[model samples]
Each structure stands twice: as C-alpha cells, then as structure tokens.
Target: MELTLPKKLNASQPITLETKGLVVIGVNGAGKSSFGKCLLDQYGSLAKKISGIHALFINNNVEEPISEEENEFSRLQSMITERLFMPRLSEYEKLILHLQSEEFEAAVNYKEACKVNPDLLPPVTKIDRIQSIWEKIFPHNRLVRKSGFIELASGSRDSDSYKAERMSDGEKLVFYLIGAVLCTPLNSLLIIEEPETLLHNSIKNLLWDEIEAMRPDCTYVYLTHDIDFAASRPDSKRIWIRSYDADTRIWDYELIESNESFPEEVYMEILGSRKPILFIEGTDTNSIDSRLYPLIFPDYMVKPMGGCQKVIETTKAFGQLKDFHNLESKGIVDRDRRTQGEITYLREQHIFVPNVAEVENLLMLEEVIKTVAHRLMKDPENVFNQVKENVIKLFEKDLESQVILHAKHLVRKKLETTVDRKITTVEQLAEHVEGIQQNIHVQDIYTNIKNEFSLYVETGDYKNILRVYNQKGMLPQSRLCNICGISNKESYLNLIISILKENKEDADAIRSAIKESLGI
Candidate 1:
C-alpha cells in the first residue's frame, strides 16, 4: 500500500492507498492530475482488468495512452474534449444492433447496470441510465429515444428529447461520466480530474453517488481543488499537495488527517504564496473573520475554517506536514465560555482567542455600534448610549430565557449521568445478587436519585446566576442581529465597512490597534 512516487516529484512520505480510496486535493497547478497519472503509471496498465466502452477514452476515439512526461492540463483537456464529443444515438446504432443479435445477455446486464438507487430518481431501464443521470441533473425532464437519436423534453414522451449534441454542457458531462462508470469493469481504477468542472454544485454529490453505484468495485481517485466536495467524503483519505519551497520552485504533498475543509482559493494562496494565513473558525459565508481580519491584517490571507476545534486541528495538522514545515499558520477563535487556562492552551498552539466572548461581541463595542448607527443615518448624537440602553434591556429579557434553558440543560445532563451510573451499578448488582444475600454498599436507586437531587438543589444559586448574566451581558449573535434588524453577520460587517468609509479618523484608530496588536 505504500507507494513511493518519483524523485523529482518527491513525496515526503509513502502514500497508503487504502482499500477505501484516495482523494487528491491541491491548489490549481499543484499537480493533482500529474500525481494521479503517476499513480496509474505505478499501478501499471488496467487494459486486462478494465472493460466497457473504454473508460479512458474520449468518445469512440481511443485516447493516446497516458505518458509519464505529460502534464496534468494536457490530460484533463483531452478528457474534457472527449466528454464533449461523445457519439449520438445513431452512432450507437451498430452497437445496439450487435447487442440485440449476439450479445443479448450483455445487453441485459448493461440495462440492469443502468438501474441505480431508487432514491436517485424514478426507476429506468438499462439504456435509460444515461437518461436517468441526465434527468436528475436537470429534473422535470425526460430523455427519450426517437429515430436514431435521444431527445430531451419537458416531462411528456410526446415532446422530443434533444440530441446529444444539443445537450447542455452539464448534461453532456453527466452522461459521459455515467457511461464511463457503467462501461468500466468493477475493481478497475477510475481516474477523474475535477469532476466539478462545468458541473453545478447542487448535482455534484448526487453525480458522485450515481457513479459510485455503477462501479462500487472500482477504486476512484478524484483530483480536485474543491475543499467542500473533498471534505464531504470523509470515507476517503485526503492528500493535500502543496509547494515546498519559498520561491514555489519545489512541489510537495501530504495527507490531511482530520476532516478540515478549506476554500479552494485559500489553499492556492497558502501553498504557492509567502503570505501568513489567518485561520478563523467558521465558513466565509457566515464568519465576520473573513471580512474584518483581512482589513486588520491585510498582509495575511484570512481563511475561515469549520469550527473552533477545526481551527486548532488544522493548525496542528499543517505544522506536522513536512513539506509545509515552514508554513506560517495561525488560528483565531471566539472566547466563548473557555477559561483563561483553556485559552492559554490554544494560544500556545498559535490559536488566537479574542478578548470578547465572541467576534460579534467585538462589533458591538460602543465605538463600533455608534459608528454603524451613524453610518446608517441614525441619531448620531446619543447613538452609543441609546444602543447600550436598548442592548441592556434586550439582555435582561434574554436572561429570563437563558436561566430557564440553562437550568433545564443542567438538570437533564445530571439526570442522564445519574441514570447511567445507576444502570451500571444495578447491572453489577444483578450479576452478583444471585450469590450474595446482602450487599453493604448497595443503596436503593430511588434513594440515590433523591440524594443527588438534593445536592443539585443546594448547588443552585440565583444570585450567582444573576451576577454572571449581568457581568457578561452576553447576547447570542442571532439575538443581537434580530435586535439590529440585520439579517446576518455579513450585513452587520457591511454596515461597519460603510461607516469606516465615511469616518477616516475612526478607521485610522482601528488600523493603529491592528498594527499595534500584530506588532507591525
């Protein structure tokens, strides 16, 4: 399973191609396709093992066998072209005739092969497998066979299904992939480059699932820069190929151990460039980290990750990548309810925790809130104090809900723990109860529960709860946005950005603070 790659393209470690599969992820030009070809080269020919309409071919044209020296782009370009130039139904007429005459059983198998998971779509016959995939891609439609051609139509068979040549690029790509999978023999290696190419994001997962059904026996190696798609397949081992040297002269690769998802552009920026990355916990869509961090540390590429743990995990994971040993990576996360010691542990690992409870809390600072209100043309005179008063009122109301919620959560958690302990003790007692007449340590389960409840009641302090709530004034991000009438984090940041545009002095202050904090 340990496959050593070529010396020029030095692998920092031997690749373990586990029976499950290998997923190759890299920035563009990081040699995802080249690595796949190298794997194909190392594994030798699939000619004897593979069958069907030629898994490696483009259309009916037999592709030039892969050469060791060929670059990734050339191979991908050929594949894309072949996928586009797939034959019409008329072209398959002769094959259909031959199947009907001599290879009837093979035809039957091909038909059955086309039939996929019922959840994929309504069931279709064998020849309609390609149609099934196509319809799924562009639904409420049907692909019907007519005189020597397949027509795409809206629902009814009376409407003509368009010819293959007339199909949309996505449809063409889907059909080609379906054919490639169905035609290929099980247990053969299928190398697909950027299956996301020309395909919509919505259909990406479904397409993979359908193809997987066609050839569960086939080992798939997907070469992609898509972090989301790659991360979605936790079943597969992900290999991240990156540049090793400072000048981007040498390329290196490593396997990502954790399920850390990053944007494709972030990978490109990290691997090839010298800029230090500011990794934050959350996706770009929802995280203010992407918007605010870039403004503060313009020199760094502010990349958003999945969550707090993911931020820490990725930082540690990347540190261990021998190829990227010199890669400067840092992580930032919300303080949340983490203790100072917990924050210190993360900081030691180069993960930064904001002083505020959360990133949203930072934006709600008096200056920040005032600036946002002024920019939105609110009463600038007492905006800060007005907002503070409103926020406090909101906080008091929120506390009412929080107290009940927290109390319920605590009671439930304690009850569950007590039940678990009781279950264990009773099971042990049952095991030995038959032999022993009396057990000195044994207490009635109901009595134990009553004692635990008394202890829980003694621990409850309303004064301490009130003091904590008042000290934090913690408004959930969603609740804060609701009060502001802001739909989301992005909108809130956008308002801040608008404010900064008009107030140069305030912007300068923010910049100064950023530079001071970063020691720039």
Candidate 2:
C-alpha cells in the first residue's frame, strides 16, 4: 500500500491505496501516465511483500487495430476470432473438437462457478457470474453464448452476433475493461487512464457501477482530467498534480478532494479557443455572470466560477498553465465592502470589482425602472416612484439580515484566532464563555451597518446612490435585476429585458460600456 519512488521522483508523500479509490489528474505530460507507470513497476517488485497485489494498467489505446485489408465483416471477424483462440493454439484442433462437444460448456460453467463462489466444490457448474456483470455493464447488448465462443451482439445488428471489431470505441473499451477485470486476480489494482475518451456519460456511469460492485475485492486508480466524472465519485481519494514548465514534468502535487478546488481541463478548453475569457462569480439563476454577461460581451466566453475567490484563483491558475498563458483572461467580482487598498490591488491584477455594493444594487436606477414600467404598458410617471419606493423599502428590511450575517462572520473569524491559542482544553470551554461575550458585540456592529446602509435607503436619494455606485463605471448592472420582490412568473431582469424594446438608447449605452470593459 505504501510506495516509495526514487529521490528524483519529485512526487508527493507516499500514497496509501487502501479500500478508498484514488483519482490522479494533471495537464498533458504532467506525469499522470508516468506516475501510474512508476507505481505499477513498484507494485510489481513488491508483489511478494504486498499480499493480493496484482495490477492491471488500462491505457485507452485500442489493442485491436483494424487492418487495412480487413474492411469486410468476415475478414474482421476472422482476425478477432484468431486472436481469441491464440492461447489454445497447441490444442487448437482438440479445443475446437471440445468446443463443438458438451465439454466446453461444462468447462465454462465450472469457470463461472469458481468466479461466483471460490468456496464451491471442484468441477463446479451452474453459475452465471460474468453474465451478471455483463448484464450490469451493458444490459441492452446481447451476450451470445455460441458453441464455439462468447460474443456481444449489437441491438442494431441484422445477424445473431456482432463482430468485435465492428463495435464502437466505447463498447470496445467497456468489453476490454470487463474482460480484464474478470481475468485479474482478486484484490488487484485496476489503473484506468482517460476513461472519458470515447464513452458516453451513461455508459461511463454503468462501467463505474460495475467497477464499484467489485468493491474492496479490487482497487481502482483512475487517471482522468474530466471534472464531471471526478465529481460523480465523491468518496474516492483525489490527487491533483501540477507542473511549472507546461506539463513537461511534475513540480508539485497535493491531496485535494474538494470539488471546489478541482483543476478541470474545461478551463483550458475555454481559454484554448483563443478568445478572451471573462471569469465572473455566481452560478445560480440570478447571477449576472450566468444570465447576462454572455449577451453583453458576446466576443468573450463568460465563465461562471463558484465564488469570488474561485474566480481569482482560476484567473491566476490560467497564468500557470503555460499553454494558456497567451489567453487574455479577466475576472469580475461583486464589491462586497472591500477596502480601498484591496480594490486598487485587485484592479491592477485585471480583476474588476464594481463600485456598487453588488450587481443587484447597480440595477436599481430610476431610468431603468421607468423603462420597465413603460414596457409593461403602465404610465412611467405613475409607476416609477412606486417601484423606487418598493426597492428602497426592501433594502431597509434586508439591512438587518445583512448586518446579522456580517456580524456572525466577524465573530467566527475572531473565535478562530482566539479558540486554539488560549482556550484549547475541553475543561476550559465552560470558563471561556467570556471569550464569546467579549468578541461578539452585535448591537455596536448593527448600528454601524445601519448607518452605512442609511445613505442608500433614504427617500429621494436612490438616484444619487446609483450615481455614486456607478462612479467608476456607467450602468454597471444595467442588465441586472432591480426589483427584489420578483415573483416566480417574472424576474426583475426579465422585466428589464422587455424594457430594452422601448429604450434603444439605454440598451446601446449599456452595450458600449460592456464593450469598453472587454477592450473591444
């Protein structure tokens, strides 16, 4: 279970491959395959010391290459049949005789019996272990048990059986993996690379299910760059490898099981398009990153990172990935009470933090509100003031919740620094009640937070608040939602989108600002 490679390995700490699976991911040439090979070699040498330590390395390279002359179905079938029967070549005629007789069936039955239950008596019969596994992996594909051999029948085939060479790459790989698993020793390690190469999502799931059914019986070490696949296997142990020199070699590696920290290739794939990537925060329906940025900056691929920190990390990560070094990547995050110093530093890093409180705050503009009312066939003069009043009132009601959340965050931050250093023991927990009391002064924090929000909520001053919010940028959240109390039937953004019909000048102004941000 413990593998120690050469000093030059530059590998991470010794990895323990127990019942828990391991996923190895890195960029191309980042030592993924090399790491796997090194482990396999080490595993082979320690086979005697490590009990039940057989290993199977599965590269996605197709073993059976379709020959140029073997274009015909019969030719391909003959080539495959010859390869399958190669091991029994000495008993070729005898084996064929037995295959024609009932003895071959008896031998296969005994093999199945041993697979199903190793505790069964000698010369066992009446078992269907492989059949059961095959069913789980490819339920629709027919497994034809002919007198001569076992073959997989495609559902679309006109004949009774399918030529092995005729199957799709995915089908072939599944067949290869299942066959390899069946033949491997119990408690062996199965190393698979690039499982997503040709397999569809559904087939990949089925293949994984069959592998999982193997359980503690056989361990799996998957080398994959596919994020969705890794996300599906949450219980598995994950090791992310990184290199400094364009994946020429490994520089560092760490055990990062968190999906949030997943170094997915999709990032490079987007940047690989050679287009500017506008990385932004938020992934939900209400997010401007997901909903509106694409329309505004049509030239750039607007990627939605899970949060502000993720966007920052990803933007930096792109610089490290040398292949994508030329990519013009920019990130934008909400202005969440950041200090002037922090805001200045972030802008210098090409990461924009809008002047407004958030995207939502910038959208609460009088002109934008009037546009929405006009689109809805209401008198703009009559409804503008009402909408403005409602937005201001909503902010006032939301102020307490916001203050409470911020205070809680600060308290937790203070507690984290205070707890372990001063009050470590369980016995001191009761005596340290004063620590919590001293750190959390909710009333004082609430007063300051209320005063800060007062400028934004005061009546007749909403337009001025928007003006100040948009000081650095023009209509920063013009495409964002304004009204907070939107219903299931219609969102505030949807209303604004409708309003764009009556306000061509406003739409043009917003688009111009967006283009300026993109440097288009």
Candidate 3:
C-alpha cells in the first residue's frame, strides 16, 4: 500500500516509488539512519530500532525533539568510536525498560501500597515476579523457558532461543532490519540505509528482491552507492546529487538529469576524486569491457562500468572528451524508461540531442587507433600521415559540433526556466535571482567546456570511429587509391602495403596487438 507522503514531501520532485521501499545511501556518517528516525517520528514511530550503527546515535530522546544540532551530533559517529556504540546500548535499554518502570510499580502495587502494602517491590525480589514481568513486556518476544526472546530458526527442535547479538555483524544487520520491520505495522513506512554493507557479495544481490517480494502493503526505500543496487531496480527513481560551492556557505546539492544510466559519473561527483571505480552491475562479463580496458589502457581513466546502458549515459553526461571509455558488458544493459508522453515533452522542449556513446564505445575506438598506429609504425611518414589524415577528416565535426549545439540548448533552457519562476514576493523574487545566478554559472561552465574540448571533439567523429584494417598493410592489394587512383606511384597506403609485403616475422606481434587494442 502506498503511504502517501505529505504535500510538503511532494514539493520536492515527485519520486516514483512503486512499492513502499526507500533507500538512503551515504558514507558511514551521512545520517542515513537519523533521517529514517525523523521520517518515522513524522509519520508516527514505525521503526523502533536501528540495526548497525558506526558510532553514537541518539533517538527517541525524551527531552529535546530531533533538530539540526541533534542530527549533527549523530552524524559524527564515524569520527568518534564511543558515539557509534550508542545505538546498540539504546536498543538494549528500550527492550528492558519494563523491568524498571511498569512492573516495579505494579509489583509493589503503588496504589494498593498507599492503602495496604505501603512499599513498591524494590527490585526483582522473586523469580515468579521476574517471569511475570518478562511475559508482559516482551509478549511478542516469545520466551520458551521465560529467560530470553525467541529467535525462530527455519527448522529446529522446536526451541525458543536467541543468538541475536552473538551473530556476525552481517547477520546482526539482517536481524536489525527484521526488528525495524517488525516495529512498524504490517502496512507502515520503512526506509533503510545501504543495507548491503557487511553483507556477502553472493547475498548482496538477492537481498532487495527478497525484501520487495514480502508484504505488498509495506512501503520501502533504499539509498545506495552500489551500482548493482542502483541498476538492479528497473523502477527506481535515480536522484543524482551534485555539490555546488556557494559563496555564502560551502557545498550544496543539485540533481543530474537521467542519472541511473551514468552510475559512474554520479558516483564520482558524490564521492571525491581519486577513489577508483570498483563496483558496477554484472562486473564479471566480456573480457573487453572489464579486464582489457582497465589493464591495457591504464593511462586512461577507467571507472567501473554499470552495464551497457550506462555507456550511453556516461558519454552524454561527461561529453565524452575525457581519456577513458566504458567497456560494455553485452549481457546486462538497462533500458531507458520514458513513456511516450515524456519523450514527446523532451522533443517539444528541444531537448533532443544525438546520443553519443562516450564511455564504452569510445574505448573501442581508442583500441582501434592503437592498432592503426602500430600497423604503420615501420613505414614511418608515408603510412602514418595517410592514416592520420583519414582519421582527421572522418571526425572533423562529430564531437565538437555536438558539444556546441548542446551548450546552446542549455543556454536556452536556463533562460526559459528563469522566466517561468513564480515571483509572488520579494523573498521569492530574491530566490529567483539566486537561481538565475546559478543558471548563469552553469551557462559559463558549458561555454568553457565547449571552448576547451571543441577542437578534439569536432575532429573525433569520423576519425575516432575505428575498424579492423582489412588491407592488412595500410593499402589493399586489389584496390587503387580512391583519391589518386594510383596502384604504383604511391601514397601512405602504398607505403603501408610495401611494409606489410616484406614483413612476415611481425605477424604474431601484429595479431597480439590487435587483440590488445580490440580488448578481445
């Protein structure tokens, strides 16, 4: 069942969550669980416990309700070891709270004491009283022999026992998730942070599907940096967060449009640079994509690939000028999720631009270039010049032209959006002004990107598209030069043909290089 969020929640972009599930992902100190508590309190205390916390976590505090400072306090758990232990202790106390309050007073018979008994039972004075209190407070906890709560095993000797805290961290995390789920009603809201942490890789993938299948009435959310997690859900609404530096404060958040397709780009933007891209959907795939690209092209920047679909996304977002390219794992790719209506909206708004595969596709092209270069190396000037000329002519406008056109489109969009802002008050008008400034900043960035990369981009379109050199040598034995119609008098094609004709010893080297370049 859909737990419809308040109108204020809807004020942000209407993220389409088909099920009740939601995920919040960040580094250890990003306050993911705290955000969940705020959600629970706002909605009425659904999840009563957190599974695994890195440090001090405070919640359900009797005095001050959660506020910015409290959130900040909890966010520092990763920084301080003592802080991380807060959640576990807090949970232990909540579970045993009945031992102190209700039972003690009831056993002493507070009201009866004023009349007949005069004293509340000081502590667990009697075993029978202890058993009675445990039953009342932890009724759902199910004690077989009345000592501790039951942990149901799939198949056992019909026993009631708990190995709860004694399990591994990953197992405890699973229990924590289950406890969090149990605290809420069957039809309640549930949000989890990166639930995959401490989890085994074999189990990581199956976890979400298992969760989604159970209890159709429950709503859920999952925030993750894991590409498999992101790409796993076809229905997930990707919210790409980009940090913008503002003069007034420090970092700010903005969304990158169509982010699910470019997990690497979004990941790098959120995570600082220098961290290698390690995780991608279906990482073990074709050798060309996962292995060769990373090994041979060590000089090029390689991020973990997120299926074939992200290849297109990586290209469009980063404009494909960067040194690295994506390797397409043929088996797994994501399909774009635009309804006919949304596609129509984009076209009418002039948002349609040719999709160029900047990531994986370009990687293939680079391999082709290396192949061409090695094949002509022996012939020197004549063969190299010819190949270079053809490459230059072929890619003259493809990259540069596309980039410039998109820059103009962004400029037009920035203008249109500012004009559409609703300015009902001076403060609202000031916000519009601020928005305009950001738009202008984006415009400047676009312009600068266009200026810096235009030359290489323009020449790359045809030149960059690589093919296996069928001529074997730079020139074919059968065909005359298309430009000069010469079979003998010569061109770089002839030079390459001459080199190949004489060299039988280099065949093994050439073949190996081809495999390397093609990432076969």
Candidate 4:
C-alpha cells in the first residue's frame, strides 16, 4: 500500500528531519509510527522478499527454529497437493529456507520434513533486491569480522527476558531499539511510540548511542512527553500538536523555535536561589532548572529572569518595603526626539528585551543593562571576576580609611611634621597597627568556635551546620575560620583547639569572656 505524509498533519509525525535527531510528540492515537513506516518503505533496502517471524512462532527451546517453520511449510504443501495440484517443489523448499536463522536451523529442517514434494531450491531474486538497496547504504566492502564471540550489550529494560509471552508494553517498545541497533540492517527505520517509557537514566544514554550509530542508514522517530529530557536541548525542534476543538480526530503540527515560549516562573524562583540561569523561554523551567542549575553553572547561576519578571514579582509582593527594586525593562531604543521622562526611566531600570515580562525574585537588586546581548555572552568566569574585584575594592577602601584614621591619631599626639615627618609618621602608625593586629590569635578563635559549636550542639541547629560542612569538606575545602570568615583550619580556630587541648584551659573561660563582654 502507498503512504504519504499528508500536507495537513494528522498527528505527531515528522514533517521533516533536518537534523540527526527528531522528536514527535502527542498523546496516544497520534500516528507517531506511521511516518516511520513510510520512510522505511521508501529508503530502507528492499529484500527480494521482505518479512519477519513473530517471536511467538520461533522455537528457541530446541536451540533452533527452522525445524518448525520448514515442517509447517511442508505440511501446507501436502494439503495443497492432496487430490490437488502440487506447485513447484522449489517454491515450497525456498519458503521453508526463509525461516532458517542459523540458531533455528533445526526447526527449519523440522518444518521442511512436514511438507511433501517440497521445492528445495532457493532463488537469488530476493537476494538481488536487498543488494541493490545495500549498494546505496553499505560501503563497497563492509568489514567481515571473525564470528563466534559472545558480544551482547548491556540489556535495556525492554530487552529483559522474563518470558516472551508475558512481555509488557514498555518492554516491547524497548525491544525495537535493541533489535534495530543489533540487527545492523543497512537500510531500515526504527519507529517507537515513546522512547522515554520505562527507561532509566543510565540506560537512556545507551539507547541514544544506539540511535546515533544507526543514523548513517536507518532513521528513528519516537514520541515523547519527557519535558526534562526535552528541555535539555538548547535547540530542540518540536512538532507541537494541540486539540483544535473539544473533540477533533485530527492533530496538526507546527514548527516550534527556541525563541517562541519561556520557562515557567516557579522554576525561576527555586533554581534562582541555587544556581545562575541562562534565560531562555519555556513552560517547565523551574523544577527541572532547580535540579540542573548547580550541575550546569557550578560557579554562578544564569537566571532566566535576570531580574525582569523577578523584579516585577518583587515589586508586587514587597512594594510596601523600602528595599524593593522595581522591574524596569528597556523596551527598545527611542529613535526620534527623546524626552527627560524616557531618560529618567532608562537610568533607573535595567534595560531588558520586552519579550520577557515575568517577575519571580523579590530580594536581590535588579541591575539592568540596555540589552540581553551582553549578558548572554558572559561566562561563569566573568561572574567570579566581578566578585573578586568587588572584594578587593571593599578591602582597599577600608584599609585606606583605617590608615587615615591612624594618621589623624598621630597628628593629635603632636607628631605633625611639615616635611620628612609625614613619611616617618605614616611608618610609625603602620607599625602600631601591625602590633594590634598580631594580638588576635587563634587560641582566641578556637576557644570561641568551641563555645559556639558546643552551643550549636545543644540547640540542635548542628544538623543544619553539619549539612553545610558536608557540602564542603572540612579539610582544605572550608571557607570560614570556624569563627569569623578568617583562617579556620590552620591558624585561627584550628590552632586554638590544639593549644587548648594541650594546655587544659578550662572551658569556663568562654562563658566568662561572654559574661564580661555582656557587662554582666
């Protein structure tokens, strides 16, 4: 029968396959496999004869199957010839030979014996047809490897063989991928309903590997509803089908581009806290985004909102609070005469493309630039660079202020000099400040962290503390000095613990210091 891809899409079917991979998605009865069968008939190598045995008919118990098909084929011939015309014995034997898989040769023979006046001769016509198709698909000389090695790949869930008769729907689907990849037919197509069904993540990778290997000759098309796997592809092309009316028999397809829609807001809220996000448009970004942000952006999150929708959400929820930053999107550049209102609005708000108009986060500052182009090009390193630079600026500003304060103190003590005394006074002030800095020893911080850690143990917030520690290994991975954000491991709290253990300082010292500091 002839089949064609209808101009009006019937339901989940590929209109085209411009890339190595294609996804056809819809609910059941969408005809996901029909497209595949059409391609198979057109491009798949034709056999002089084409057919396959249903596994239920194969007798693997005897270590062979030909023993059965041949017997069946021969018996049919005898029945046809009884007081009737006996066809060519060659045709009967040839048909029986069609069932001769090397492993099932015994069954093939058995089936052959059941027939009378069998046609044992085989024809090369079907073989020639297959060769013609293979000529286009296979190289001039496909490699001939020595056989007799057991080479079964790790089985997918579908390949599990509890029993052939009791196979599940999911298992049967997986069986197609397994058989198609293993068959290595030069020209064919493997069409499956849902590749994601019953597939574990680890084995899912194996299925894709098989698909890629078959791409040189075979074309695969499967339907899926897996938004998690679906959204991972930055440039995924989807044939989106929707119910046109309350009850329509037909499903139409549209080419969905990456720029069309956006991820939902809930995902932005959750993933926004954990990792930076790259803002793309989509429906299901949050739950999946939160799950993958840390894996993708280990350093800084590329938030999809970029304070666009997030800023708006913040404004709506916390407009009463003084700290709330408003969502200000810079729509487009005003080409003609600009006004003060436009300039003021532009100056106060982050300039983002107007396509995105959702708000999520209500906490952080919204630093808007005129365009999304600059932000999209930034790497994770650029984020860290900003942090490091800001930290240096903070420290330098504090350090210079402290030096000025010390210089003013010297001036009060009558150390003011018109010439060389300025330089000498600066040096003396630095020396005094250095002496005070050395007085803060870890024996102090450790005694301090010990008290704090002990209190944490009492309050049961220690579980939360342990969680933070586990997140970063204590050895060479910790950030804080276990006291302040200083040297926690080696010199500060670490050294104090060592000294106190050796010196046997009373733990009461911490309480005493605390009480004195409290002026109790």
Q: Provide the overall lDDT of each model, using Cα atoms, as 2-decimal numbers.
A: 0.58, 0.57, 0.42, 0.35
lDDT of 4 by residue, 108-189 (tens): 5646765853655534333233223322232231211113211121134233223322444333333434433435455444
For residues 99-176, could you state the per-residue lDDT of candidate 3 as single tens digits? 334445555565666576456454432223433333332334432322333232322446546544444455444444
Per-candidate TM equals: 0.57, 0.50, 0.38, 0.31
For residues 118-233, could you state the per-residue lDDT of candidate 2 as single tens digits? 88775421113445565666767765565565566754556578544465555545554554454456666666667666677876766676666754566667777776676566
- Residue 54 Cα positional deviation in candidate 1, in Å, after optimal superposition: 15
- Model 1, position 438: C-alpha lDDT score: 39
Note the clash tally of each candidate.
Answer: 6, 0, 29, 44
lDDT of 1 by residue, 1-520 (tens): 2334422336455445555456777777777666676667767765122222232233445446788989999988976885679643432343344323433555455567668633443334455666667677678777766544566678775765566567665665666676656655557777777767767788887788777766677777777777667865656666677643435434476655543444333454466455777787778654566667777666676777777877887777665653543667888876554545677888787887665544655565655655555555665446555555555554455554444443454444444444323435766756555534233223343344334433333554222222223233343322444555667656777766654455476675655544343224
RMSD of 1: 12.0
Best by lDDT: 1
Candidate of highest TM-score:
1
Measured on C-alpha atoms, candidate 3 has an lDDT of 0.42
What ranking of all candidate models by TM-score puts the best one first?
1, 2, 3, 4
Better of 1 and 4 by lDDT: 1
